[model samples]
Target: MHAHFYAIVNQHAGNYRGYKIWQQIQEYMIQKDVRLSVLLSAYPGAPEDLAYDLASSLPDKESDVVVLAFGGDGTLHEVLNGLIEAKRHFPLPLAYIPAGSGNDFARGAGLKSASHWKQGLLDLLQTTHAQVINIGSYQLQENQPRRFFMNSFGIGFDGSVLKRANQSSYKNLLNHVGLGAISYLIAAVFTIFQTKGFPAKIHGLDLTKSYAKAYLMIVTNHPYFGGGIKVAPDAKLHESNLKFVLFQRHHLGQIIFDMLAIIFGGFQYHMKAVDNTLLTHDFTIEVNSGQTAQVDGKSIDQENYRVHFSKSSYPFWLPETINKKR
Candidate 1:
């Protein structure tokens, strides 16, 4: 029962260290006598196209192929979308190696540290232990193409933070020093004073509500976001439900306090600022015109979106030892 490993490497991710890590992984595979191949992503969204082509070429029945994503959460997001687009009902088994600045998905999934990820990946490739996790989907309109996310989706405050951080020189500097999470915190502080609340309406699975001035709306599939912040402490990846956390228009001090709470694992104590926290299988958010949004830390230029949470069509391989610990 040999496995065919294909890694989709993101060359631009994580302080320009992807190529070096890929080389190490290739050498390790050679030493272990395992089959290995790689597809380098040349540009944004290239992983999706490559994943689609690879998945489409597979035989109808299950095979020994395993797709490994060697980038940040965004790379995994693109690859997942590509495989789902190729075959909605039965995508290939997937694995991941954290190699990006904000690896919230890896943290939430309890993956090994970056220094030890090669051994963790090798362990998965050598066995068939896999888990079925849920994926979140959203569309701006009923007729629009659906976008998938393996982590959290954010609007207003979170979107602004990501936009600012991506455009700032600090993020790159932080990445180089292996302190990428601090970049997001700095961006959030800068954006907090400048951001304004926007009107929003949320229609959840069991409740519907409206807000005249909403500062933040985060929908999460797991407990971590913004590089290991436990924003949704109770979220489970295997559950077919989405957890929503909303922060209405609040004072700068309150916002800062909440941010600190999230950073220091004290979010439960600051739940007063949270306008609503609910679990729903499906929901829709209508934001004021000109507002922004983000899906899995990537900014989106949209004011409205309908989100649906459901189990993934395929399973993903995880290191058995790590899975047991979780």
Candidate 2:
């Protein structure tokens, strides 16, 4: 276990739930006499800046240092990007605490904490070894720098939902009422009528084909997305393979069934799989038409681009009590 901690916290996330959780954690750390350095992010990209400068200034031989991120998947996403952008030769051990409404990454990564964080938090802080697991990486264009995502990638319908949800006034209202995750569902309902879907060309994966109207293209490294929904039931984080789940729309009736099933409950159980889903080592997706995109629940502004997906391993400072066997 690492003695020193570099914690990047977002106090305003999840309607100040991040701040509330931090209070509990801070008291625990003090009681245990653990050395903690707290950095609070005030705005959107603050965590990335804080993490980038921190990693850039750190020594290469510090085996006892762990950078702890205390926020949502998006915060973790920024922190990991910052560390990678620093161009360090050695990987910095990471520890994460889920403070967002839809902590799908935490669930997908087999983390012991989510709803029951009190005991789970203590277990992780006292964990013996850092758990090594596979993470995702992608590139938007040929010359563009590679970026990382923790959970899954989405394009078209789901991306539009996330993009809208992030900016919607009702989202804040829902958060105030402790229904923050339902924001995605509400946004998706709006997008369903506004969006007509888009076409895409698939390549690199063994079974490549053209998609007429890809209502949803979610390439997952694990089983969870949009809170606890198992969009890709067979996808596992420990494994190196990425599962591609695509939903094609033939008509309004077909897509209403496909998209609604995905939001309310698990999609895999409702639909029969034939050519819609594929699994491989890696794949390249090209969308010629304009559409929205999202990585790990955060919106990407780019439209009409090529993206490639692959996997790499990172050591997350987590408890061994996590289903290590999985």
Candidate 3:
């Protein structure tokens, strides 16, 4: 039986879904046998800091302690990165309850139970074992510390659309109404046609290409992105290989078809405009200057940056679900 639980919560996630759920369940959790400590995040990066401190505070072999995260994928992303930064000799187990709009992490990680997080937490409370999932990491510059992601990373159109959706005031309204995904749809519709496209050079996984007008390039460790879209069907949680999928707008008609194929499914694999490559070893992706980038749904500013990609590991103490464990 676990003796203690450390909960890192991002209340603002899913437009207060995380906080609202936690508030309703905290009393019940406190009454349970396990000791519980809670930390609320005030802003971005707070969860990461809280996760680091919690991991550092635990003993190396503290098997009875588990860190529980309650938020969307972005919150989970920070918590995992924080644990990685702590650099503990042994991995610390984590449990998650996804309460965000685009729960791509939950979708990919086989935690659909998160939709009803109260039950999800209840199920997790009974689990005694944790499964270790291999995650993804990247570096914008050589010799720099690695940044990790559990879902996927994208540059060019994929990222630009997310940036616009996340920054738009309509996102707040949509999130408030539990229709946040609509923002992504609206943004995508406008971004695709407006994009002039950018250049890129990709090298790794026995597949190399240089594109003069790469509309979108994404590296995914799992199959789901953009709230449930199968962005890279070959990518899976248990698999060690990453899928680097790229798209080029050689012609307006062809580019529209590519985007439609991606959104509606089927024919993407056969399209000449789409390049889906399996990345087995370390890879380098150089994008055109002043491009927007995204990792696990967070925006980034990368200009002519050559990002390095690799692998990492995180131990997840998740409740068993119908989906295969990763």
Candidate 4:
């Protein structure tokens, strides 16, 4: 069990659960005699800066520290950016408590909290089995080489949806109305109506292919996105590869049916018109003209980008054995 814990919290996360979850985690850790440090992100880029500082200053002995992220995938994404900026070859392990809307990474990582958070903490503490999960890295064709992503990145329709979702004042209200899936639903509907799709050429794996027009192109290192939607059912974190799912131009009915299939977790194979495949290492995506790209949830102003896969053998400890043994 890790004796020391540090948490970087996004206070404005889904329904304001970030602080509440952090307090609960703190109480639980105290009960187990674990030392903890809590840092609340007051504004947008705070957590990333703090996390980078911490990662850069990690002790020489690789101090027993674990970072608990108390927000959605965006928070996790920021923490990852900070860690990468810190340039730690072997960064501290990450522990996630899904407190934000669209906790996609948490669902994909299988670390969603149960009815009680103490159980989650105990599970992390008691587990022994470990795995080294692969994280995808991407660089925009228009931007410098400083930016990369650890989660799913997208272009075209999905990126546009992300833009709207981030700007919607009704996002929180919708999340409260449902299990954080409402915002995505609303966004998807809007995107379907507004987008005619875009053109892109994608080369990956044995699937080096081109698209005359695509509704969206999503590159996932893990299975789920937009909360629990399994965008690519076959993507595995431990697998040394990436998965690409492209929705070609479709009619409104096809779009609606494909969205339904995605919600049901078999859209890739179920939708005959969908292009879904895996890439071993490198891939390039070029759009016809102007296109928006998004890494994690941040939108990038770019028309093209090249993704090169590399391995970061970070040690990840999980409760897989205990949870799966049942």
Candidate 5:
């Protein structure tokens, strides 16, 4: 059987490096004798729309098609939405080549540098390792239907950071110089200083736990976000559940101290006002009327939204692997 490669390039991603990286991928696939197709996103929202259309059209041929993403987490998020909309199920696999700022998803997958990323992609094609993993889904209370995400989603102060990050002029600078983490750090500090605590009702693995209002609530399928912050330290891709972590309300000094500890991987047990909780499955967050939430870095203004861990609901394709056991 032959393998087909579908490369999606977001020209605006990471200072317009998508096209250049796509060219390199195109050439590499040819060298490997892999069939190739290219999708160039012309503007914002184009990639998601295009991916959905392609998934709907279904390539005429039967050879496996691997969608190689060539941008940051946001680009992958868009592709995931399109694939989900196309009805891709869990068996469907996705590959990444980090070309954008804050390449957190790729970093978590053990593909840190360009050299390592290339090796990982080749391994996916040549090795005997492929596993179906669950992805997270979200839906607002009053908006359209439900949507899906492959990374982290949240509500509250951190959600506000994501919203502002999207609108930041620093994004261009971040993409150009690969300083996405620094940009997020500056924005987060600014956000924490100005944002006030808000009340939220959370229900998941445990509901009786009590505390003051939360700074934010995050549900994740992976361990990293905001570039490299381990938001949900125990999240795994193959798991059928989501990891829930809450930064409960506390004094500014305490919050700052806890955050510093978290940066060093030493804050998990320093529970004072609130615990760094973890959940394995579904969860809900109830906020005052007129609150907002963010899923995969995209913000939605809604009173509340319910997000959960679920198997992929579409027909997705994974790279073929060689077996050594046989």
Candidate 6:
């Protein structure tokens, strides 16, 4: 039986690689006799709009329906949130093609670049295997709309770094040449000097704590962050809990050293300066006003927020071949 494949391509991702990859995937799908429909995301929230429309229009046939996101983690993040918001009773397996800077989701899932992505995706569609992963949801204030994330969320230092990188002119060019991770490092150097710790309170899982100078807090659903840095080595996608890595105020020299250590896989040596906490089910973090936050690489304006995490309602399709090797 032929399958229905919906491809949401982010044209601006990966320095113009999205269009080329989409064309290649289209040719391959046509040759395999699969029914394919393509949608190009023209702006920031376009994927969410496309995903909502596609989910609402799903046919009642017995054939399979797959949604493929072609972009970075942020693109997939938007698509996943849209799917959840659609509130469809039927299952829709989601696929991703990495075409953005800092494709951490792809990296953690053992997926490679588009060198052989066509064949890999074809294999994924042919297999019946799908992985049910956890999703992170957050609301900045009371009665506000909630947002979901699949990778990780950051407040303070990391958020500031992402904000800087987004404003930098070299990010796209660096991504084009396979040096996207360097962009984060460059931004970190500048952000670290300017970033200051803010007052915050954490209440969750039978524990309560307050910090006067919380430099950064990273809540992770997966192990990788900041372009392949293993911030939480024990994190797994199937886990129901979230891993929190809090970096407190430290000397500039120590902060720089730890940053380099994370990049070089020496984070274990700097454990004394960082606090690692595991949160089950839900938590609330109250931060001082005017602090920035980020979810899945997109900046958010968060002052006080509550985080609730649980397994996704549906399964995410991953390349079985890649999963086996990992």
Clashing pairs in 6: none
Point to the candidate with the largest TM-score. Answer: 3
Query: Tens digit of lDDT per residue, candidate 1, span 1-326?
Result: 57688889888887686567767877878898888888999998999999999888877576777888888888999998888888634557888888887788888778764567677666776666567777678776777677788898888888888888888898888888778778888888898788777777887567788887778888888888777778788787777667788887767777777777777764553576576465645667777667677888888876455544333435777766665323
Question: How accurate locally, in lDDT, is each candidate?
Answer: 0.77, 0.76, 0.81, 0.71, 0.64, 0.77
* Local accuracy of candidate 2 as per-residue lDDT tens digits, 1-326: 54588889988768785678688888878788888899999998999999899888988664777888887778888988887788777767788888776778888766754346677677777876676787888999889888887788888877888888889897777766557788887777777777675788778846577877777788777887776767777677777667778777677766667655665666545565214454556778888777788888898767486898777777788766777544
Candidate achieving higher TM-score, 3 or 5: 3
Residue lDDT tens for model 3, 1-326 = 76377899898986775577678667778777558889999987999999999888888775777888888788989999898889988868888888787888887777743346666777888788777776889998887889999988998887888889888988888877677767887888888777766889998767588998888889998877776767776677877778888888786777777777877884587887788888778889997678888999998986677999987777888766625534
* Candidate 6 RMSD computed on C-alpha atoms after optimal superposition onto the true structure: 2.3
TM-score of each: 0.92, 0.91, 0.94, 0.89, 0.85, 0.92
User: By the TM-score metric, which is better: model 2 or model 4?
Assistant: 2
Which of candidates 3 and 4 reaches a greater TM-score? 3
- Candidate whose lDDT is highest: 3
Q: Which lDDT value does model 6 have at 78?
A: 92
| Candidate 4 Cα deviation (angstroms), residue 210 | 1.5
Off by over 4 Å in 2: 112-115, 205-207, 263-279
lDDT of 6: 0.77
Residue range with the least summed lDDT across 10 consecutive positions in model 3? 317-326
Give the C-alpha lDDT of model 5. Answer: 0.64
Of the two candidates 3 and 6, the one with more favorable TM-score, higher being better, is: 3
lDDT for 59 in candidate 5 is 48
